[model samples]
Target: MNIIEDLRSRGLINQMTDDEGLEQHLNKEQVALYCGFDPTADSLHIGHLLPILMLKRFQEAGHRPIALVGGGTGLIGDPSGRSEERQLNEESVVQGWVSNIEDQLSKFIDFTDDDKGAKVVNNYDWLSQMSVIDLLRDVGKYFSVNYMLAKDSVESRIENGISYTEFTYMLLQSLDFLRLNQKENVTLQIGGSDQWGNITAGLELIRRTSQEGEDIKAYGLTVPLITKADGSKFGKTAGGAIWLDEKKTSPYEFYQFWVNADDRDVLKFLKSFTFLPLEEIEELKKEVEERPEQRTAQRRLAEEMTKMVHGEEALNQAKRITHALFKGDVKQLTKDEVEVGFKDVPTYKLEESEKGLVDLLVEASISSSKRQAREDIQNGAIYINDERQQDLKYVINADDQIDEAFTIIRRGKKKYFLIRHM
Candidate 1:
């Protein structure tokens, strides 16, 4: 299938300007497209996945994808999805975040000089040198105040008060598109549905600012904003944002996030996120309908997505931890695996002064009181090193340690504790 058809089949195309004309243009030659990402945080979360995946599809379809780091725009937050004005970040903080985001994006695209290879651009280079007079006279005149105020982004914050800095955000963004179009010949801009207004503004600027009869053309496209079936925000868990960086989010947790996708959203997520062939996805859907208990579709989704973000070694480690945890076989896990897999579980150090199992359980917060601790041990509700410790008299000496330093403690099926020998 062609690029547009591929995007349509995968449900990635939510809104576009003149899809037929764009397809015809793509059929004649490779297109130059871009998507801008603001450096709002040091790491990108799962919410950034849709746009990045769309860029990947574009590259696969023999188009050049430019990943634009919003070093300039990030200083002035985009108010598209927010309910209120955002707290503006410091320039240094935003720059640091921009560096981090650029690094993360590099992993997802090819940056070689080959045709259709991805490229990275920073708007800060040009934006920082722009003077106020030039900006107001040259770019501001093209956008009217009435047109800017009518946008949902500006309209929603009317009562709460949108700052002048943010009010001028669209003009700056439009400048980026104009600059890119002039320099890189980038003809298409893509983003989440919320960016439709800004993207169209950029296209309008490109059209009006170019010399008369210059024949410069640009297009805008957007994908649906990802949301959970339950109406909660996507890319968040109890721990926090599911970061693309493995350090921020372990591979196992990242894999689990996709594996635990709601049944209603999995197919849609697969279409939007993965590059799996339509036929293969259709087969997986049938399998999901026939025997979802096996979770074959979920596993494949987890595997492909995990590998894409974390690489093969990390994916394997995640799978290993998943199997070990589910089978109650912690011994198979490596030292690093144990550290990462149980990082959030409470930990306590067992000093030589601690005399018995009761002291250990109480110290680890495994029980509320000494009496409860003793009762739990006697009732076979406590385990040390995955073995039942029914005897209240049992002492947790250094001899009962794993790796000569630690022991795994459990008060029940779910409550876990890690004890270190000091």
Candidate 2:
């Protein structure tokens, strides 16, 4: 299938300017396309994955993908999809964020300096070079206040109010497109749905700035915003946004996020996020219907996502943690796996070499008192590392520790506490 058809099959094309012309343009030669990611945060979240993956998809189709970091415009902030003005960051902070985002983008797209090699550029390189007078006389002259106000990004913010800095963000972004087109021969710009207005504005600037009869072919495309079947926002959990950085969101947490995807949303996620062929995804769809209890589809999605973001070893560790937790057999897990798996669980430190199970439980706050701890042991309500320990005199020693570092204690079926051996 053609690249457009492949994107269509995956339901990725949300809004494309001149679909026919753009498809023809992509087919003619190695199209150089670009997408802009603003450094609003230190790490890109799962919310940013669609566009980044879109760039990867294009690259796989023999196109050159330019990952543009909005180091300049990020300082101003885009008002699209916002209720209030964004808090501006220090130049040094934004630059640091820019470098971090560039590194994250490099992991997803190859930039090996080949025909289809990707490129990472920062708008700061050009936007910082232009003077306010030059911007007004050159790019700003083409966009009237009326024209800017009509844009949804500005129009929606009229009641709440918009800043002059943010209001003019489109001009800065448009200048980026025009500059890329002039310098890099980039013809297409893709982003999330919120960027349509800014993207079209860029195309407008490109058209106006081109000399007569130049036959400008710049285009804009936006991917739809991801939503959950339950109506809550996607990429969000009780812990907060699911970041691509493992430090921000551990591989186990990331794996669990996708593994716990709602049954209603799993198929759509597979299509949008995975490079798996349609045939394989179709088979998984059947599995979801026939054996929902197995959660085969969800597991596949988790494996693919974890392996892609954190690599094979991390994925294996995540799976090991997940399996050990599920089976209530955490004895085989390494110390690192235990740490990643039970990261959010309450923990207590064992100060002594050996302590009675009841004393340990009371000391760790796992039980309200020694009396309760003995009662819990007698009633078969407590377990040490998934092993039922009804012996009130049983001592939690080095044998109870996994990797000689931590012990898993369960008060009941689900409530768990981590015990760190000193």
Candidate 3:
């Protein structure tokens, strides 16, 4: 199937400007399309994946994908989906985020110099050079105040008092499209549904500034804003946003996020996020219908996402941690895996080399008291490294530690505590 058809099948196409014409244009030649990512944070998160993957989809279809890091526009934050103005960051901070985001985007898009190889561009290069007078004379003149006000982005903010800096964000974005179209022969700009106004504004700028009968063919497309069936936000957990950077969110946690996808959302996530064949996904859909308790589809989704974002090694490590935890065989995990798997569990630092298992349980609050600890052990309710330790006098020695760093203590089936051997 063609790129547009594939995207539509995945429910990735939310809105397309002239869908018929854009499809024809894509089929005719190697169209260079771009999606701009504003460096609002030092790392891109799960929310940023759709647009980045959309670019990849086009590149796979023999088109050039441009990953535009909005070094210039990030400094002047886009107010497309906010209720209030965004706090502008220092130029140095934004530049650092720009570099970090570029590194993250590199993981997904192939930048090898070939016909369909992707290109990464920073708009700060040209936007920084243009003077205010030049912007007013060349780009601003083409946009009337009424025309700007009529846009959803501006209209929504009129009541909230948008700053002139933010109000003109559309114009700055428009300049990007026009500049790329002229210099790089870019014909399409893609973003999330929230960016529809800005994308179309850019298209308008390209048309207005073009020579009469120049055949300006710029178009815009947007992926839908992801929502959960439960009405909770996507890309969020109680901990916070699921970041792409492994340092921010470990591969284990990232894997868990997709692995725990809601029954209603897992199929949709599989379609949009993974490049798995549609036929394979259909089979998985049947698996979901026949036996969701197995969570086969969720596991596949997690494996695909974790492997794509983190390497195969990290994915293996995550799976090891997951399996070990589920099987209550955490002793099988390495020191690093232990740390990741039990990161949120209650923990106690053991300064002493060893201690009686009963006393350790009392000290770590795993049981209510010494009396309770002894009862739990005798009742076969207390476990050390998943091994039932009924001996009240049993000591938690170095052998109990996983890699001489941590000991997993379980009072029952699921409640776990971590003992750190200092």
Candidate 4:
């Protein structure tokens, strides 16, 4: 199957300018395509996954893919999907974020000496050096205020406000496409559904700016805005964004995010995220219906995605940590496993001169007050080292240390605390 058909079958195609024309263009060989990512944060969240995956698909099909970082556009935020004008970030801040994002993107796409190896570009390289007079005469002449105002991105913000900087964003983005087309032969631009207006603007710019009979053509394609079956936003938990960086989000948490996918959304997620063959996916769907409790589909989904972002070693560690935590088998866990599992739990420190279990629990805020801590201990709602410590007078000394430095404290069934001995 062609790349477009593969994207359609995988549920990745949300919108496209013209599939027939695009497919014809791709069949000609070594077509250059690109997708832009704004460096709005230090790390990309799950929301950035689909477009990046689409770029990977194109590269696998022997097409050249350009991953454009929006260092310039990020300074003037893309107002396409926002209801309000964005608070522009500082130049230094945006530059730092751009560098970090570029590093993270490298983990996903290969940049070696393969024939169709990917390339990275930053819009700031070109956009920052252009002057207002040159921009208005050369690029801005093609766009009209009426056309810009007509877009849903601008129209939605009219009731509140839209800044001049943001309103002119499309012009700058279109120029990026024009520059790439001339410099790199980039013909197709892919992005999220919200970027439809900007993508089409670029395509139009390429058409209008080309010399007579240049025969250059451009296309725009977009992927669906990922959302949960229950209509909540994706890539977010109580802990905030599910980052691609391991330091920001541990492998175990990332695995759990996929493993806990709602029964209704699992199949759809598998298609969009994983590169599993259609036949294998169909078989898994059947297994899901026939034996829902087995959760074979969710486990496979987690394994594939975790290994993709983190390595196989990290995936194995995450799996081991998951099993150990669920079974209360802490003794079997390594120091790294303990750190990953309990990273978010509240922690307290004992100076080797401090008092007992009650004091530690109160200090850690695992209990509301000292009286409450005493009550919890008496009622067997407290555990240390996975063992119930029911006595209020149980003074915790150096003897209570696990691995000679740490204590795992639990209040009730869910709340956990870590106490470190100095």
Candidate 5:
């Protein structure tokens, strides 16, 4: 299938300006397109995956992709989906975030200095030097206050009150588009559905700024905001946003997050996120109905996404922990894998080595008292390292450790506690 048809099949295209023109333009030539990411945080999360993958899709279709980091505009936050004004970060802080985001972005898009290769541009390069007069003369000339106020982003914030700083964000982003179109010959801008107004504003700037007879017909496209069928937002867990940085969120947790995708949402996620063929996605959809218990679709999505983001080694490690946990055998997991697997489980520190299991339980408050601890042990309710602890006087020693670092203690089918040999 063609590029547009492929996108349509996967439901990636939410809103595209001049669909016919874009289709023809994409078919006729390798159009240069750009997408901007604001540095709101030091690391990009799973919520940011759509656009990154979209860029890859475009690049694979033989188009030049430009990943623009909003270092300049990030200094002033975008109010695209916010009710209140954001607290401004220091210039240094934002710069650090910009660097970190740039690094994270590199993992998604291949950057090349060649003509067809992807380009990474920072809006801060030129935006930081422009004065207020430059903004008025160049950008403000095109955007009327009425047009800005009518936008969904601004209109929503008007009641609660948005700052003049944030109110001018569309113009800033539009300027980024217009400038990129002029310098890099980028004719298309893409972002999330929330950025439709800002994108169209950029197209308007391109239209007004171009001289007569100049072929500066720019276009904008957006992807729908991902929503869960269960009425929750995607990329969120109890721990918070699922970050791309393994340090912030371990590979195992990231793998588990995708592995547990809602049955209703998994097919859509597979279509939109994976580079897997349509036939394969359809087959997975069938499996979701035929054998939902297998979670075949969820497994594919997890493998593809985990390997794509965290790489092959991390993906294997995540799978090892997952399989080990399922089989109730975690002895094979390394120290690092143990940390990632049990990071969120309840943990207790033992001051002394080779302590009695009863004493350890009472000291860690896993049981209310020594009497309860013995009762739990003798009653076969407690387990150490997945083996039932029937002896009340069983000792938790260095030998009980998984990697000489920690021991897994289980009270029942659902409860787990990690005791460290500190």
Candidate 6:
């Protein structure tokens, strides 16, 4: 399929300046396109996934991608999604973020030096050198106050207040487009829906900067914001943003997040997030309708995303933890797997001893009293290391420990606690 059609199937295209023209331009030649990311944080989160994947889609379609890091624009924040002004970051801090974000961006695209391979560039190279006089005379002259005020990014912020620094972010972004067009031969800009104004501003800069009647055609496209069916934001869980960096969000945690995808949303995410073949995804969709109890879609989504982000070994570990927990075979887990599998479960550290399960249950508050603990054990409702403990005086022996450091306690069907041997 054509790149636009493919993006449309993935629900990636939000707005494009001219669909037919851009498609014609794309099919005619391998043109250069760009997407700009600001160094707002040290790592890009799952919310940043669409754009990164979109760039990859273009490169695979035989186009060149220029991943623009806004090292310069990051200092003056864009007020697209915010209700209030952003506290500007110090240059030194933003520079660190730039380094981190650059490294993260490098992983997703083809960056090998070759024809049509991706290129990473910093706007800081040009934006830091331009003076106030030139910025005003060249870029500021093209944008009118009325036009800037009408943009959704500025219109929403005008009531609360907007700083001149942020107000001129359009001009600064426009200048980046102009510079890229001049230097890199970049002819198109892509971004989130909120950046429609800025992307158009860049196209306008290219238009006005060139002499009249000069051929300086450029284009802009944007992707819609990801949203959940129940009106919550996407890529958010009780924990927080799902980051691309495994250190911030472990591979196990990331895998579990997708494994818990809502029945309503899993199929949509499989298409939008994975490059799985359409036929394969459609087959998985049939499984969702036929036997959702199996959660086939959720499993595939989790496996695809976890493998994509964390590699095969980490994905295997996550699956091993999951399978062990499901099969009531906690003894199969290693120390690291136990740590990740039960990271959010209640934890109580204990001095190593052969503590009887009944007394330990009462002491750890797993049972309300000794009578309750004995009743729970006798009723076979308590589990030590996932093995049923019907004996009233089962002891926590070294054999009960998974990997000699931790014990798993499961009460009834779902409640779990991890006891660490200190």
Score each candidate by Cα lDDT: 0.87, 0.93, 0.92, 0.87, 0.91, 0.89
Q: Write the per-residue lDDT of candidate 4 for residues 216-320, one digit (tens) a residue.
A: 678999899888988878998999899998989999999999998887888999999989998898998997899989888999899999999999999999999
lDDT of 2 by residue, 1-422 (tens): 98899999999989999999999999999999999999999999999999999999999998999999999999999999998999999999999999999999988999877644688999999999999999999999999999999999999999999999999999999999999998889999999999999999999999998899988889999999899999999999889999999999999999999999989999999999999999999999999999999999999999999999889988998998999999988999999998989989999988898888888888889999998999999999998899888987898889888999999999889989999988
Highest TM-score model number:
5
Q: Which residues of candidate 1, in runs, are more than 4 Å off?
A: 113-116, 353-355
Better of 3 and 6 by TM-score: 3
Give the C-alpha miss distance for residue 121 in model 5, angstroms. 0.8
Estimate the TM-score of every prediction: 0.96, 0.98, 0.97, 0.93, 0.98, 0.95
Our model 4 lands, by Cα RMSD against the true structure, at: 2.2
> Candidate 4: deviation at residue 92, Å?
1.9
Highest lDDT: give the candidate number: 2
Supply every candidate's count of residue pairs whose N, Cα or C atoms clash at under 3 angstroms. Answer: 0, 0, 0, 0, 0, 0
lDDT of 5 by residue, 113-141 (tens): 78667988899999999999999998998
- List the pairs of residues colliding in candidate 3: none
Model 5 bad stretches (over 4 Å): none
RMSD of 2: 1.2
Which pairs in model 6 have colliding backbones?
A: none
lDDT of 2 at 65: 95
Weakest lDDT window of 10 consecutive positions for candidate 5: 108-117
**Candidate 4 TM-score to native:** 0.93
